[model samples]
Target: MPRTESPRRGRRPGDSGTREAILDAARARFSTAGFRDATVRAIAGDAGVDPALVMHYFGSKQALFVAAMEFPLDPAEVVPRLVAPGVDGLGERLVRFLLGVIDELGDANPMLALVRSAVGHPEAARMMREFLGEAILDRVASAIDTDRPRLRADLCASQIVGILVARQILELPELAAADRETLIGVYGRTIQGYLTGPLESS
Candidate 1:
């Protein structure tokens, strides 16, 4: 009889299945424990892998969170697009882009997941703050000629986050029922003002 090789007993390292398993485990852990408390060891154990393997694949917990969450948009890519057209109509463009993303992604919006995670978790909130402040708002503020850029960016972020919470998360009847164009028009002016308007009351 021909010698038969023993079949593989478990998932191989660096394999697609292994990666997906890790991601799945990470998602579950993050959902339950939030980013602050979710440990790499725990996630690896959930995936039936070594903690080293998790670090090998994801490099860090933050990277693992990002991978697991599958954020719908990359702010790095979006900031350039928003700033390329000049600051004149940046608010409208931003609102249009944001609404378009929400429309396009619908129930699959990753911002929903992030917001939910950040709501009750301090670490998750910090992650969100850093991501929005540094990646999106800060970059946008830097691209334009303005005073108190950091404050402006933060203000814009507040409005944008509020809109997302009200319309998407809370599902407020008025906001959810409002037309996209109406939202864009109203929010656009507000964001534009934050980006370019005077900081002090005249």
Candidate 2:
């Protein structure tokens, strides 16, 4: 017969390193093995704790994921800033914002963490969609003056997101090698067209 140990036998709640250890283990496991494969048992084993303790601290895998991937930026603020009066020079502004987001957020871009998890989990992708729709698209659409601002906002978002994914995340060669100024120069005009272009016929 297999030996059965008490569920609460491992690390206790007040242990100083328990939280950090679990987070570290989660990041490594989720990054390498993905969310589904990176089970509580595996993370607990990696952190040298009991699986029940992982549940005790984080409740569920979804809750643990949210806790692990929290970000600094408030999307409500960011959307307004992105469309401020002087932001006509959107390419430069976008490049600056993207670089600044990386700098300001440092190791805490929940968007990036969401992307990583989405590579392995559908729920993470859904969360990202919800965030973009509420925090980004809805605000930007309300702020713009055009009749179909929502469509324009969506297109602009898709283009910039695609660029970021290709350049930063996937490391596309030309984009990855280009200087910030060059990238802004190339993509800024394109963004402007999307923002205030002639309305499309139905």
Candidate 3:
């Protein structure tokens, strides 16, 4: 009888298990190393899958980030909505959009996962800071033509971050029970002050 060849073995391409493994690896990389450092090769290595599999499952790094973050909407589109109301009501518009996303998740806030995973990791923290500052909050401040654009942006970020941590992560009853309009009104006002109100003593 002819000798039989050994069977080729490894994860099949594009299997759901492989995709989940990639997601798990991606979460780990992004939470520890941040987006820029979390390359396909590194993630694939961690996932024990082919690098090409990662690309096959997720078209690009950005697409991977969007998937990992479970982001509800496109910032490019939603960010402009934050700007649509102009300077005066920018804060309110932003709050509505953001909290609306949380609402969409029902029981889970995807952002909470990002924050918890990134809080202790310096690279992850930096990525989160950059994202919030550059992608979301900063754009609003820049759009509003605020007196101190960067400062206002940072302040706005802090407010929203605090809310996310408290309401969603910490599960504060007062915040969790509050209706959307109420939260929006309160947070919106607070953010409005950060956006346009005077921070310095008169």
Residue-wise C-alpha lDDT for candidate 2, range 75-168, written one tens digit per residue: 5556678767543665467656876676466456666666676656766555555556655777766656667878877877787778757766
Local distance difference test, per candidate? 0.81, 0.68, 0.77
| lDDT for each residue of candidate 1 in 69-158, tens digit (9 for 90 to 100) | 797555666788888979999999989998999889988888977888798787777667765665677788887786888888888888
> Which candidate wins on lDDT?
1
Error of 3 at 76 (Å): 2.3
lDDT of 2 at 37: 59
RMSD of candidate 2 to the truth, in angstroms, is 7.4
Tens digit of lDDT per residue, candidate 3, span 1-202?
A: 3375322225677455777777878878876776666788998888777888789888777667677777765565678776876888888987988888888885676688768866866777877875665466666766767478888888888888888889888889988999999989999999888888998978
| lDDT accuracy of residue 76 in candidate 3 | 53
Off by over 4 Å in 3: 1-29, 36-64
Clashing pairs in 2: none
Q: What TM-score would every model get versus the actual structure?
A: 0.71, 0.59, 0.70
TM-score of 1: 0.71
